[model samples]
Target chain A: MPVAIGLEGSANKLGVGIILHPPHQTADPPSPHDSAHSDDEAFSTRTQKHTSPPVQILANLRHTYNSPPGTGFLPKDTAAHHRRWVVRLVKQAMKQAKVQLEDIDCICYTKGPGMGAPLGSVAIAARTLSQLWEKPLVGVNHCVGHIEMGRAITGADNPVVLYVSGGNTQVIAYSAQRYRIFGEALDIAVGNCLDRFARVLNIPNDPAPGYNIEQLAKKGKVLLELPYAVKGMDVSFSGILARVEEMARKLETSQTSGGGPWKDDESGQPITKEDLCFTLQETVYAMLVEITERAMAHVGASQVLVVGGVGCNERLQQMMGMMAAERGGSVFATDERFCIDNGIMIAHAGLIAWRMGFRTPLEESTFTQRFRTDEVLINWRD
Target chain B: MAQPPPQQPLRTLPPPFNTSAESFELIAQGAESLLYRTTFLSPAQPAALKVRPQKTWRHPTLDKRLTRQRVLAEARVLVKLSGEGIVAGGGGRKVKDPKKKNDGGGDNGGVGALRGLVPAVLALDWERGWLVTEWIDGVTVKLGIYQRDLAADEGVLRGLLGRIGRVVGLLHLAGVVHGDLTTSNMMLRPTRTPGTNADAMARAEEERGEVEVEGGLEGDIVLIDFGLATQSVSDEDRAVDLYVLERAFGSTHPKEEGQFDEVLKAYGESMGKPGKVVLRRLEDVRMRGRKKSMLG
Candidate 1:
């Protein structure tokens, strides 16, 4: 039997997975995330109150922006980051699996649904490694990987995947034998809006800016009516972005010396940081819940799986849980490993595909940054 | 279940000069002609035979000229489009007409033999007015399960488009237009590496690259059926050719066609030198196509 290692380097995340099952194997869940870490020494222990089932964190690492902030990391720079981190990450993952290098069978990687520059960089590296090692590689859809990882961790085989990320925010349903994109952002993502608003607010791209913003929204008291817009399955955040800018600019201008509205009180029923945080949290999470409810009604699927960096929001999860319960369906939320970026999902999804005989030839080892989940034919099924 | 073939007493003539063993089994009866499948029991040899009905050509003088030109055109186009004939199936160069002079016109079999197009073998009148050519072994591009079965096989699609773009470039360079460029016309050939067998073991001692590259690749791609094609010097025609290919791409293969950029990218790369003028006009052609679709 051939041991297959999967490599995923579509964007900044460099991932590799190994699958041992054969194409002839009977139907079973691939890489079920129902086990605790094979070894616990490699991680820093952090305990939480909720006892979610221990996920099989089969070796994973995330290397964020080596390049300085301000400007987005160019494609070449991102690829360089991948080339440096991939080998090391894979080695660490193997150590956790306690498997030798060659024991790795096929390598699976993300081909696209990302930037072309980043995609090309990963492509060259993957193609070269596969050629030298003579390993069959499988290119996977990044979005699909997110969805699959969400399912693997949550055990939701057919939940509507709501992917909310820095670049993408969409309410997707599996229909017509493909991922029919039911709703999406008209312009920027909810994350992008938050990041830009944070830029205006001088908020860093910290892991929990959403959580931090939620904190500040608590202080805000004045009923600052902001734009709330949602069209059909699609949602618009430009209005939200514009509304925040207007409030900020208004506050700044009024306090600039002359007899302005702010000059009288310096702060009129001043919107506290908590209120802003609460309002932002309420607004965004409400929008998410609204769209998710709409998607459940649309797909007739009561269960919803929220997967992405944004899925970590407590308010978002709470609302989705409330919505799911109201509809008499379950809401699946991935643990931190599946929520924040990690190689585990790639490994999880890749292993499933490898078991299903989705192998790649050497000539096609290029990375695809923008692979649509709907484009790939599902190889694994319930 | 037991329907008999045509009643024409068109003798059991095998398409000649093909390395195949079995005779040509006559097929499809056209008002003006007929088609045939040339079968060879030998695994190594492959070919096809096409035959037209008798007295289909009313005018001897004009029919002779047109058929002669069409056959010559197909052969000429194949020469330029097919690389030193490396990856292409060796086309049938005009051989001696074996039909009796009193029997009249030669077989009009060479209409689709252009660029080692994959469809037929021995595409010419071996005895009289018959077209025969090499038979290809592959599935239709539409049926290629590589993408579905193998995840990283998107490159195979790109390579196919690259082959298409390169061939289209060749035809355009020679001022030829393949009026139809659809999924059915494309075949996915297996890339054969050195295989070891007793016969292959015996042949291993034989040389490499064998200056004689006759029976090797079938030229990676066999674009079949150029019967509705034409050779011209107009940019309009060249753009139309691409339009046909692009449209066929969208309609025939919807799921896989999402990678249409690969085709255009490859086309942009291969059509580098001669594609300058026509490439510029391609924009206009696309614009006009969009306008026409909207209005119509």
Candidate 2:
């Protein structure tokens, strides 16, 4: 077995994980190896049939920096928080995995598409570990990490990926050697929208604001009308966020008046915070599912894989499953351990590349905040 | 994952379609609508019928709202383009007035009016998601480009490309953006003589495959498929629209991709002042790429 450790601090979360890829069983014949330039041909050949070996997760750990209620985490503070906990998490992960210095093959870290400061902080930690352990370094695209980990956990091959997190929302699929983006949020991300709305309602920052909003939404009864801005396969959430924030203000002001509940003008019924949460979830999830379906129809793909923090929401999973079922397909997702930002995905994806003889030199191990999912050449996948 | 079973045949056609179902021949099945080739009022006149089927997955209210909104939006753009002094009339004369044809027969009006750049909307039913328009008799620009030898017919190809640019320019000038712009969405309507017999017109369309390579390119570029179109006057939106076309041309016609500059040049000339600004913005858009960076 080949083992690798990954470090991730793209946003406010700092995670460390160790993973192992067991050698293929000798009973099954090995697949043919081809040159990277023939990736399209390789993909077509594998599309007929391909199976991946099981991956063992030795240890996975994360520490999130949550801001106070009514506020959001700043890049500077989040970066400082990551720098403080990354070392401890890495040490604990190694101890938990019962691994030695010689057992580790390479050190992997998120290279970007996130806050510059946080990404840089994690890169520095990864660089130090690479030198201390005298191992090669592999720079991983954060979004790719989420996707690769999701696939490994769910066993979905060549599924369309809907990656939604606080920083990004994109519909991606493998074509040639890249995970081409088919659609995406034109403005604010879905998770960011939910998190900011939670701020307006002063939701607790304990666990996660998105998770809290999901719980509250389950108790909601009325489905208030919200702007549904889906243009082609792309969507915009800024308008929805602004409108919901205004509604939250009205609810607060009306509640202050003799402690009465805010009532709708037309129906004259009380509207609770739960109603707001419900409306936001229903509207946004619908948009997400619609775009995902469009992409699926475009590529003629039957399987869909949901990744990132928003993928952890049960409501989103259920809605996605329903949409997939209607298409006579299925949806693949993972629990928080793999769906949310975690180092295991980075380690897993990077290990795959490393096995294919890919490595990031010490000098080129720098991180970028503007890396695109399609920019990375996926040498590991056919 | 398994492939979805073949869709079941529709149980019954909606209101206006119920009586005309037998006459309609299914042509294409799109994501949002089913396109059929049929006749309008009489058997001699051919028409294109677009039926936006209701999606079972969506809420009835949302589905109805989207269907109605899109049907109206497409109709509005087509009507505006086909109206007097617009693209159909060449920006000066009334389409309904025969005597005023000479005045409209100039740089902008002459080619557009005579060419029939857009199919005239004959009828529409927004509530039922049905829009019928005069059927265009021509081959798709994709086929035209593929059939024609670029090296031997470079001049004609450039002219056709330029006209396409002009048509798209007129569309953007009218504050409308064809969200999806591809070679496949454009038709090369064969030119017709004033006294040409109906047989000759049909023959020209039928002989497109055999004559295209030898006869050189001939026809007006008519844009179609407005399912994703939007009414927008912003330079950013206009630039994105052109960018989409530019990408389509690159991928679909890589052999003649270098000739695309002619398209942009003609597009800029048709756009004038606003077009110039949009062309400038296109540079920035191209540099950053169409979609925004994935980072927060």
Best by DockQ: 2
lDDT of 1 by residue, A1-382 (tens): 4454555554455565443433333444433333334333323442322233233344555665433332344668877877787677667767766667676666666666676765666566667667777777777677777887777667676888788866678787765355656566655678667755665555544444555575565555544445555443456688888887676666656556475544213345655445445555566666667666655653457689998777877667877886676555788886555676555666566666777777767666566444555677774663
Task: Please write out the lDDT profile of model 2 over residues A213-259, one tens digit for every residue.
Answer: 99999998777778887665667899999999999999999888887
lDDT for B170 (candidate 2): 75
> Which candidate ranks first by lDDT, i.e. highest?
2
What TM-score between 0 and 1 does chain B of candidate 2 receive? 0.75
CAPRI tier of model 2? acceptable
TM-score of chain A of each: 0.83, 0.92
Model 2 ranges with Cα > 4 A deviation:
A24-53, A258-262, B1-12, B18-29, B37-40, B43-46, B84-115, B134-164, B182-220, B243-263, B283-296
Residue-level lDDT of model 2, residues B17-63, one tens digit each, is 79754487766554466677889888888999888777665556666
